[model samples]
Target: MMIYTPKAGNAPNDAFLFNVKERSDRLMNYFLMVYFVLGLIFALFYGTWLIAVLVGSLSLIAYYSTKLALPNSTMYQYVLSAVFGIFMAQFIYQMHGMFEMHFFAFIGGVLLITYQKWRLQIPMVIVVILHHALFSYLQNSGMDKIYFSQLYNFDVRTFVIHVTLASVLFYICGLWAYQLKKYNELHLSQTLQMAELQKESLLLLQREQYNEERSTILESIGDAFFAVDKDWVVTYWNQMAEKILSKPKSQMLNSNFWDNFDNSTNSISYQKYKKAVETNQSVHFQDYYEPLDNWYDVSAYPSEKGLSVYFKDITERKRTELLLIESEKKYSDLFQLSPLPKWVFDVETLRFLDVNTAAIEHYGYTKEEFMGMTIRDIRPVEEVPKLEADLAKQLNKDELTKRSNFWHKKKNGELIEVDVQSRDLVYKSKKARLIIANDITEKQRYIKAIEEQNDRLREISWIQSHIVRAPLARILGLVPLIENPAESLDEKEKMLEYMLQSARDLDDVIKNITEKTTITQNFV
Candidate 1:
């Protein structure tokens, strides 16, 4: 029911005005053409070709003049009104005051209303009054040539009455035209306002829909969210906020923010919120709330309206992080206190990242020096190629652990063999391997000595079993021959000589055992 008023100088209304002017111009041209045709018909009825030609020429001029004038100009409307009046007057003169021709003046007045300019009708009214009074007076004063009617006597009273009546009728037509113009203008203004109102209503509806969708999205998020105005009055509280804060939205809305959460004033959460609002910036932090006995990751965003806060419970995550840190500390202690040499090195560059106390003592290098050096620096020069190949194989393998026996050089230039146990893991967020080296140089040397001792022992046992036994068996054979009484003295002497040979063989075996034992002792 409201009457919508457009803004001043609205461009759409300006365009509407131009359109109305153009349409009025076209209508005026059409009416002038019709009026010219009517003038022609009247001339033909009266056999006045001059009048018809004059009227046609004037009509053409008026039509083109109006067309040439700017549509926005009121001058064209006035010119058009005058042209219509002149054409009608010419038709009336040719018809000699015919009532039908008189009616043409009223029609012209009505047609002028299409221009929607009330002042334009004044020209037509003036032309009608002048035409009727002057022509009637001339005809009554015996001016026969200009007489338009011969059927009635031309008396002064009669002429006055006729002119007066015609004047009143013309005035009435002019009044109607004026009222019509006013109505058209009002209608055009109202139509333009109605269209603008409809467009604004549609825009408002779309804005409301967008806000509703945004609200739904905010409500659906898992994080607790709330908004406060510049006055610190709560304006919005999502469902998650209600659940996390243990308060309903009905109690939160329009409530003072500090009144609801008084304990938070001295806390980091409140400080961050205040800072964000004061600086008009976004703040993100994690803090523990004593009231809830929980940690929260909070973010505050400031806007012209005020501040909005989003928070989520992070107590579980914090506890897990603490446990992980403790576990890493225990593992670090074990690694550093281990008796065997241990180190961590980058997988890509093979540079040592960390080393235990045992590694520093065994490798004869300071921890700082080890950190600046690569794993290859500790290996003997001759084994570097094999080390590179093994490293390449390890890179291609998905296995977590690898073992290899590598000869390493110490800081004193002493080469020691080591059994390396390497396990792959992430160290300081980088791909790296942890190496535990078991120094096996002494063990390998002892193993070799034991092997040599076993060989010597086997050789001694073989000599005692084969060579010693053969000599003893000969001796036993000779003793039996020498002890026999039935045998002759020469036979006994020969047996004694055989016994002496066997004894010599046994002595040589004993000397061989003594010499081998001495050599084995020296080797040991």
Candidate 2:
């Protein structure tokens, strides 16, 4: 395998310190210019050509000393530049005391303490301190270089004081550098550890995001989903499962599945799930009712460690089944006890599935013996040829219902007139027909009886209105002829009037009877 590396110029983090580097370079350049100006000022202050030459030479060295481009140079390069600049300043001050070199050395030592080694910076500090003390002693000692023998004193105390002060200054510089180095090392280690912790934290956040996304998808599905351990404790419960079972996941999950629950029904689903786990086999269950309102089809499959269960509500399907059963029961009872004959037949096969009690009686067959028989069996042989096409038409249509008059032959070969009403229906998962038949063998006799009663009432009404009333009318018309033929003819007139009143009463009775007969005919 080969590796690819980004070119340095285009690498993004490679320019991380570019602005800092630029600023650092500009500041260093400014410092160089300041060094040159300071050297020029010191040379001017010397007020002599040779001294000015010496000062200018030192100034040039300080200005150009750090102008090197080394990519891998350590911070020690900065320390070295500061040392050289300080030495140049020392030379300038030596040539002319217009500026204090001792104070400049102090500033250089303070800067060197930031980067230089403790042991190394100590010796430099001692040299600067010794130079300071020697200068002071020389100033106070004498006006000229008088001979030591003539001086009568070596000034041992003065020498001792100068050495002691230098030693103390070196010791302080060593201690300062050592403490700074230790502090830098400790700070660097802590910073690296903090960066590593941040990386680990970011990885954990990504893992959590992935898990949350996965869980959201699972909960959005409509099926109730759950998982359990080998011991049958609930491990996971999805949102649908919570909604269907009316149980909160916080209270139910991780608990024993058979524990006391808030379910409306103590669901056998939980029990069946446990059984599937114990048997280590998958189980499929159908048409199980949780309550009057809840029905489910469920399956549990064994997993390596436990079981996974899935189920969906089938309440609508179960409700439809119950409605069909109730409808069938209502019609079955009516057919069995009804006075009129009735029969149920399979439409496709045209075979009888069942018959009511009256149908069996009228057809002269037992209930069990009549089942599985065909409609043609009880029909007249002459009618069978024409019946095939009619039955076919009935079966072919989506819904076929009609009333017809047909001839039926009894088991003993007696012919009967039957009024039949039939409709297509489904029976026991098969297409069938429901038939109700009324035997009309005595229908004409009943009609004749009603007609006779109606005719007699009409005749009586005619006799009362015409025969009886006409005679009464004739007697009233002859009332004037018989009136005064005898003494007291008024008495005969009263007797004729009573006969006319009797005739009127008979006519009223006839009219009432005729009206009642019409109503009876309508009811029949």
C-alpha lDDT values of all predictions: 0.82, 0.66
What does candidate 2 score on TM? 0.40
Whole-model alpha-carbon lDDT for candidate 2: 0.66
> Which prediction has the highest lDDT against the true structure?
1
Of candidate 2, the 10-residue stretch with the lowest lDDT total is 145-154
Candidate 2 per-residue lDDT over residues 1-524, each given as its tens digit? 11123356443322423443454455545654565455556556454445445654554454444334333333333444344345544543434432345344544445445542465555455455455455545545763532112223436685577456645655676678678767755665576578779988988998899779867866887788888788768888998888887778997788977663435234676567767877878998864544446788898999887887788888888889899889989977988999999888887677889899998888899877787588999889998876786777665666567777788899899998888899877788888878999888789568787787777677767776676566457656656755656646677767667667766765676566677666666756
Maximum-TM-score candidate = 1
Q: What is the TM-score of each candidate against the true structure?
A: 0.53, 0.40
Task: Tell me how far the alpha carbon of residue 509 in candidate 2 is from the true structure, in angstroms, after superposition.
Answer: 43
